[model samples]
Target: MAISTVEATGARVAVVTGGSGGIGSRTAVRLAEDGLAVVVGYTANRDAADAVVTEITANGGAAVAVRVDVADEQAVAAVFDTAEDRFGGVDVVVHAAARMRLSPLADLDLAVLDDMHRTNIRGTFVVARQAARRLRDGGAVITFSSSVVGLAFPEYGAYSASKGAVEALTLILARELRGRNITVNAVAPGPTATELFLQGKDAGTIARLADQPPLRRLGTPADVAEVVAFLAGPGHWINGQVVRANGGIV
Candidate 1:
């Protein structure tokens, strides 16, 4: 069955990649609350993505779940197509889908590096290209990066490198958009309490990393979502910049 959160009422639309994941799920809900119709893009776990859509609908917000492979240009394009076909047009894009494999540069498996680049780096570019071409005037494009890019933490090289490319793309794309009135920016988050981050680490390690932030606590998905909401809505002047959403971790 096709589910929709709220009736489309000519509201702005947002396509959020990785909408089944931690921060991405929260971001989809937040944008819906902000009066934008949302298309939640997920690679796997249709049930998880459906749950997010269900929550948004239950809250009287507008949302739909779509399957997308971030690395697949056609799939990503179809996500945007669904948004436009279901709603009106896309005004905001949050490319938060990514793959994180922690390893030092030396011992990292070559296949692992290939997978990371295909999804993280190449996927970001593919999505960004589509957003740049299709986003309406006064739209916003937000990409995800990690605070580890600045922390230079061990075992984060491959992931950080992919995000670094995202940061660079954010800047140049903003300039390239020139008179389009679109804002392109990257959000670099610090250590957040997401399942992706908590999976393999011991409790002690997680606690230690959380305490590194001056706030002395890990960031919640909601915390990051707020920043995304800002960039997508009122943060119009913040183009071509990376807003570090980490709580003083870097």
Candidate 2:
């Protein structure tokens, strides 16, 4: 279920990949609050995606839920294509889609590593390429990384590597898009209280994890989404940078 409303201010459209889950959904809603029509792209969980759209619409925001696999080039292209066809042109792209794997290097599953690479690294490039092709002048693109890249924690080696690649890609993409008046940046979140972070952890473990941060608590989806909202809206000078939203954990 996709919902779009007329905007008196002539709303710019944004495409948020992975707009069904915690951080993604929050970012989508926040962008809508910033007065942009949002295309909520999801891989699966169409119901969840549509629910996000419903909530945004109920609040008088414009949004649409579209199914897309970011790792697939054609699907990524189609996401932007549909957004453009529906809302004139896309002006912002926040890439919050990624997969995670937990294992020490010596015991790392090769298939898991490969999947992480495909989804995190290659998927970012695919979506960025589509954004480059479709996003209007003076637009913005925000990509996701993790604070694990800085902390180098055990069992996060492969994930860190994938995000490291993302950092590099974001920098270069920003440079490449300089002439186009588009800003490319990344946001690296740390230990957010989401389904992805809570998976397989006991209450004690989760408490310990939360306590490790200087703020004495894990980051929330809204925390990261606020930063994403800044980058997508008023953060024009913050290009080619990775803003870490980890509560000084790393």
Best by lDDT: 1
Clashing pairs in 2: none
Query: Model 2: which ten-residue window has the lowest total lDDT?
Result: 1-10
**What is the per-residue lDDT of model 1 for residues 1-250, given as tens digits with 9 covering 90 to 100?**
2468477888989999999989999999999899889999988889999999998898888888999888888988888888888898899999999889998788999999999889999999999989988899999999999898899999999989999999998899999999988989999999998988788899899999989999999999999999999999954588899999899986
Worst 10 residues of 1 by lDDT: 1-10
lDDT of model 2 at position 238: 84
Candidate 1 local lDDT, residue 219: 96
Give the residue spans of candidate 1 off by over 4 A: none
lDDT of 2: 0.89
- Cα lDDT tens digits for candidate 2, 1-250: 4655644246888999989998999999999898888999998899899899888888888888899889999988888877877787899999999998889899998998998899899999999998888789989999998889998988889999999999999999999887888889999998899998898889998998899889999999999999998988854688899999998886
